[model samples]
Target: MRFYLQACLLTTLLGLYLCISEDSTNQDEKLPTIGVSVLIRNKAHSLPYFFTYLVNLSYPKDRMYIWIHSDFNEDNSIEIIEAWAEEYKSQYNGMYITTNNSSGPLHSGEQHYVKWIPEHFNHVIKLRQQALDFARKQWADYLFMVDADVFLTNPDTLELLLGKKLTVVAPMLLSDGLYSNFWCGMTENYYYLRTDEYKPIREREKTGCFAVPMVHTAVLINLKRTVTDKLTYTHTNLQSYDGPVDDIIIFALSAKWNGVELYVCNDYVYGYVQVPMEENDGIQSDVEQLVNVKLEAISKGTPLFWDPFFSKFVDYPPPSKYGLDEIYMINLARRTTRRELMEQSFKELAMDVKLVEGVDGRTLDFTNLGALGVTLMPNYEDPYHKRPMKTGEIGCFLSHYYIWQEVVEKGYQRVLVLEDDIHFTPYFRIKILLLLSELEDLDWELVYIGRKIMTDDEEMVSRYTSRPGYTYWTLGYILNQSGAQKLINAKPLEKMLPVDEFLPIMFNEHPNDTWKSYFPNRDLKALSAAPLLVHPTHYTGQEGYVSDTEDSIVLDGSAFVDGRIVIDHATSRIIGRINSEL
Candidate 1:
């Protein structure tokens, strides 16, 4: 009887162990249902790539559901998605595609334009919410929101993200150079806070994941754990140092309020797809498109010649024996503060500089101004109160003229003329020499180191080639004796416009014969180093310098055409275009 009782106990223990083992096996085999929610507003071109990666995810398609929300009928994105859904619905748990009428105009003008600000921000927020709402209703175990522009190059991206078991996480999506989809910190007032850790995070040699204040482009949420907690993509009243906040910031703030931490993973690579140049919406110029392509190539670990004008890389050439006779810096005498800044800039460039005392426009006699044929147009308008060239403007013009006189009188072959507010890039000297070598055969009147091409003239020569065009500003340039002699002989005093404005007239044939006869269009050759070798010191804000040019301006209501300067805070929030690794 004792042996029989022991045998029954052993049988019961074995049965219990088998039951536990079967249950564990079932749990290991069960796959979580994942819903991919994508909103396609204007990304029809990206559909082919997006669908290719989506269909190829390492995660089981039988357990995955894809929901595409599109509003654009023109791109045929809806048709493509519908066909994909029809073909794949049987393979997956569910496939859904929905189209909602877009809320705003079909094509809002250039995104960078000031007109489409908060309106653009609100439109995007609404679309994201629509996607989120649709995904939430499907009872997905996990919901992933991806921009059409993001191409998931990793096959196991979904599986890898699921392993983290985090409430919210995103893969690192980068553009061009150091720009990425995540900001490391936030300021007290909620602006993009730049911390010292930014470089370390961006330049990490090994793969790792790190916490970030905000995440965008591609993100995953554990819907069962996080989304059910009533999180939302809503607009808030948060204000940054610049203007009103957008949905991304609002989402970040909301998540933080709910005690949810956002993380970005850089353990694997993903491609931020770039728009093709031919399909570009005419917002970016051809030159910009070429630069974007070059930058995109560099970001993908490809080696190429680093054009300092357009790239952050600095490849210095050996110091050139070619040297200018003298470097003249035009600065106001009373501005001892500005003079010091110029001195520091010259020292950094290893250049010997002479300071040309600027003529104070305010102190100039206005009674004889008409003799110089200076006339303010009756209909002239200054948007930034930049017109009606102040006494400072006259003084600045005369300073360049004085330098021109010195160049001609001293028989200097070439002189470097720089503004007091000039700032140089690291490879400035090398770039200048390289540019000179390229144009050695051609005689150039002026070579602009830094200038703003205000007009959209497609006929302009390729950058670095001696081109005839309308360019603005004179921050840094090289003028030869012949150019100086032409300026002195032209007697520019006859029609004393701002020096910058007069330059184009001097270079081109003017309609007015009085000016045309004296300043006949000579080979006033000018070229710019693309990406520009110099910028205003104020832009860099080095040496505790403030702009002496615009510091004293007081714009009254009367100055504006509409009696008020319109502020569109949304313009600041627009994300730049993505450059693809391909």
Candidate 2:
């Protein structure tokens, strides 16, 4: 009986130990290895932004194996890639670089970077095959192929693709127009056919993982769901090769033949693909001119989107280097949090600031315009918004008005006006310095450091800046003495309007034909920095962000449709999405 009891006790102990061991194994499991393959041809202009996003991917750097091929080069694109690879070479598990493409290199300026030549196309396919084979040999669990022009804002792009568990997938990339990375249907001629679902999915009106005919630019191939050996990007796997000689199309055909499903996920805004522009400067505008990475999360105004999550505000010198008289931030008394955030940002950057106390419209008596030297049309509704201005809007306008009044009263040469919720770009100080240098000789009253491009006519004034045609957002700007005097002389206090809308009217750029008649002497020479130096700290749906004029709702970002601009509601993109995933 004693021996039997001992045996039973030992068995129970052994069972508990096994359970604990299994739990430990599960907890310490290694993440899957990812193989990143890239094909570049004279896209060095966009490399800096691409590298910025690539280095910060959420996945472990050691877990990612990189293979870069610049088959046909014309400029220093190969050199740029080599430079980045040299810096980050050790961080990755493995690195492969090849500039040998039998297709031959193009001269300084030959075919457009995006060419359809058979030889070039064939070489692309061959290189893709080589990359895939290389990934397979490395025992990679997944393969990521990103073109040089693709900019991934979301660091978890790889993880997100993996979660879908699809054979092949890509995050839909947006452009200035309706261009994206996926095609809904392929025609008989094997060209892209726009279907009804294409626009809706691309616009995120219908958000989900959608099965599509083609996916490229930035796509992930899940080896777990696919047969590694059966895949080919060339015509070998295709039943018929009547399609265009483009490698992406051929790969799509091969994918279809190999029983692989291609999908594009639009559930979230990941990043964007740089569409081919008419002028081929062979350098990325963002790198050459400090252009903002064009995106579409907050407003549907311009391709240039504000990415505060990765904005990575660096502790650089202040705009004082840009020759501004004084830096002032307008903050509402109730918004202590915004003030704190802005204060911290400025403090970290080590900049002096003068806080402009915001006036509460709720307490103001607009009954007498003479006393305030401001005229507000009685019961005046916004012409475009088609609604009476909110009390908050009144407060916002007055806050800005009081600042301009200060600018004129003090006779400041150049004063930077910033809203309390302003978010700085990573290279704000340097970019501003570079931009102001270009504008020093130009004639201008108001120089906008940041704004929303409401129209398409953003004509380039200098290499680094543009003439903003009907822009919005008074979030950041440098008001000169002339600008301040013009605002006061325009009798803006008599006809009250949102500061943003009023600025456009004052600049003679408002698209609305009706508002021009209301304010006739409207020609305040204004210019905007191309990439925009600042944006709101919180995007439309972000938790702490508040817009008095645009959106009064404290939550639900989708409701923030500023003048028919439809956009997705972001729930703190990185953290919120991860929580939901968990």
Candidate 3:
């Protein structure tokens, strides 16, 4: 049984010792146990995403205990924790939930004794101390400090951490980007605090922590004798603050103080959400075929970097003009064309209910100038071939770019870009209208017009952009004017990833932009709140995919087109090539 542990080269001495000790241990002894502590507030917003982790944890349920520490007495936070505890207990019988009242935002490190509304810095430090105390009292071997918003993309995250010597803060990598706040949540103070004479690191790629950049919700810490002895926690550098007191800085300072080797887990498994990946295959369409191809390639040790841009949801080089959203849509179309199955899939996607123009053939019910914005499905020259060219999705990009240039000329600040084949929850439109109304005051840049698996309650921050939790699916997001400007003024479409994944990546990746998630793109909200979008599952009584074919389609002698069409009952396409034979 080979297990991989993550660490920086600074711990070479300790690493050798640990290896020798592990080798000497008898196989009869039970494997070291890893305990996880999660601190959550405002359960309504963050719990759903937490639940996804609870149900999908990668380690053995019996070997792990999840301690939920929250400040929820006055507000409904405790009740939400209690409810989730019951569910977790029902599933993972060994899991436990604990509640504590926080002194509300600790403003400074002083005032250690608990008081209601303690300084934000004090509150977090105290909470961490409390969690550590609980773990010590319980006699757990290792403690995993996690946040409610953090989830494991790879279910075997624990397996990866087992037997590791104090795995410092690490972030998970996804097709979208790194899955940790360490990258995206950095403020001016954050960089300054991390370094001695802090000079703002402007590089977008220098996201992951230098010497464990972040102690985000998901960190594996060891309760080893070496660590337990030298650790004397203090709060002197951080002054009056209202929010998270840069725990990563504290960890770094402590590591410097003690001889403890601060291992920076640089693996993708321990990365934060902001550090963008080359591309993610998980969120791509034709998943089965894609997965099979990747798996086969991996088995054969192939580089599997062919058409690297296609794997990205956003093109690498963003469009360099105003209102180039159309080019992005076309880029997505070209990528989807790679999979032969996407052609009919999108046509099937069109069967969902749409607000059609009655007789004018021009306007629809979606035109709400007051509270909500509306998207008018423009008819392209060839319609199906919304673009003009074919092989490898060339003209589609130009066609969409032209469309965006026209729309921008019409004075639309922010518009929803939906790739006609996108499926939605039944109430997607209604909910979007309400979201639009709510976001009238918000400074957002984009609004997704699709369906996705949403997690978390309401108050979610730390999005890849200043906006968090709105990653992966681009089905529905609301962009404000500034964000709109950013998109329209971006670089070439080829410079970035796909649009759905690109906006959040750019927002978070940008050295200056401050974006956060106002709302998560989960299904419950999309359906219950009358969002007004539906998939074939709601209309044609079919799931999203039905066929297992490997061919494209041709419509009216053209291959590239916009608007959804179904090949069978389940699959659909956004913009794809036509099968010459069909």
Candidate 4:
């Protein structure tokens, strides 16, 4: 009897130990491995958003791994990333994959330097392969490759990806006003439309914007394919070339070679928000005119389309006029002499004033590319002083950077960003000022006339979802104080589209949670704001070349210097030096 009791107790203890051991293993494998790789160039400002996004994803902590690769040696981002990874390792298993010093070396003037200098293109391809290798080593199930700025909005994004066995899940293409290529056409009687004229506007050429549903960012694929197929193919294909495969054309071509079926889901998995502008009179005018026309032209005296979810249009009481004087107009060709046609229009539109004269390098620090020059007017002593010429477009990044960091510190209501070349009609100014007065409480960051020409089709442009006329164009967009500050506050990434492309709408494939910017030019009825016109037809006669010629630059690969615009050997443009003061 004693022996029997001892045996039973030993068996029970052994069973308990086995159960505990199994539980421990299960705990270790908490989340499924989801391999993700991103590129973090010199611009580290975009880092915090990406990190914050990773933190918010609804997935198991131990299951995911992220690799960030940068080119600049020991770039300033090293410390920031090291600190983040150290702090978040317990919760999120993040890794830094750098190629700055790890790769092979080449002889410099005096010392040996790393040879593997991955710029935008080669960097993308390298990172993709690196991700696959890491995944294979980690035995990760899948890989998600995207730009560092991309953020997941739907926490269930991981849940959606779980158990999916696809080669590519192409993210939906959302447009920022800059990249909108599709031209929309409005019917002749677009405003206060009658039933007979409500046909779909057609006869416009389709641009490439909406055609390719697949952008490289937010690409999810099986890990095995990424390693054996994708990586191997890239090496074989681009073996002779030492460039990157980051461009959209390369992405599409690569997917074709790999025979990957692309899937595009519109679940707002990622949100691309940007800083807002204060001068979005185009959108405001459209919304007002559209709503007012609809309400007034109602034969049955019906209220505006009042769907709570979609319909945000509401009528308010008339405004009390303050009798504010009209503001001065700006012209782009003011400094440089323009063609006869542009000059005539300029005079007719009260834009006869020329751009301010060029300033010295000491005053206008164009070399840094971050320092902007502004000349304040005496009468306009208010905050809206400091009118800069091409700086509004070329040096916008710097302008906004300064306004956010300094101007916001002192209580400023708004920041008006104007381009010297833009011409405004009297009606345009009146309607815009009125709209601004009306929507005073609107928490908007960006306001601009989306002037990407409307074609015959009502579906004017692709990439961007629109309401009506004067869609958001990058021509002359404005950002508010908060929007400015946010851009200043956030870390910027080196690899990015122009400022126009980086705006909220264009920033990501998905929409953002906190919509920081808006183009309120939805009202087709109100034609008062500046008419969004086509691109300038003429270039200044500075380049007096009757025929094309070729020019080239020689580089020692020692130090970098910026002189007259130098087109690299890669670009499609014929290499040449036109006469230019720069």
> Candidate 3, residues 1-582: lDDT per residue as tens digits?
123233444378688888888888845766567677877654333344345555566666666777776663334556666765775675552576666656452234533222323355455677777777777777777777776544354566666655344535444332221123433233545453343311222222333334533444456667756555334233453344333344555654465456555433434333212121122322122222223322222222221232222232211222121222221232232333322232222222221221211111011111221122211112223222343222112222233334445455665555554443333432222344455565545544554444342434324321212234444434334333455445555532422122333444444421212111211221111111123242222222333332111012222223332222223324332232224443
Query: In candidate 1, which residue ranges exceed 4 Å CA deviation?
Result: 1-14, 72-91, 100-104, 107-120, 226-228, 235-245, 273-582
lDDT of 2 by residue, 1-582 (tens): 999999999999999999999999888668889999998876655666677778868989999988998856655667677777887899999998887545456633446555445656677788888888888878899999888767777778888888888888999987645778999988999898879989999878899998889888888987755464666776766565677767788778777877888999998888777555444544433342323233222222222222233234212335242477788888878777667666655643456789898876544443433466554444345666656555567678888888888888888988888887666775465677787677778888998987877787578888777888887778899878998998878877666667788899898888776766677889899988888888765677866656755653211122222211111325422110111213
**Candidate 3: segments with Cα more than 4 A from true spot:** 1-28, 72-75, 90-96, 100-118, 163-169, 172-179, 183-210, 236-248, 269-417, 420-582
Error of 4 at 188 (Å): 37
Q: Estimated TM-score per prediction? A: 0.47, 0.60, 0.43, 0.37
Q: What is the RMSD of candidate 1?
A: 21.9
Q: Quick one: ranking by lDDT, best first?
A: 2, 1, 3, 4
Predicted model with the maximum lDDT: 2
* Model 3 error, position 317 (Å): 34
* Each model's total of backbone clashes: 2, 10, 118, 47
Winner by TM-score between candidate 4 and candidate 2: 2
Which model is ahead, 1 or 2, in terms of lDDT?
2
Ordered from best to worst TM-score, the candidate numbers read: 2, 1, 3, 4
lDDT of 1: 0.63
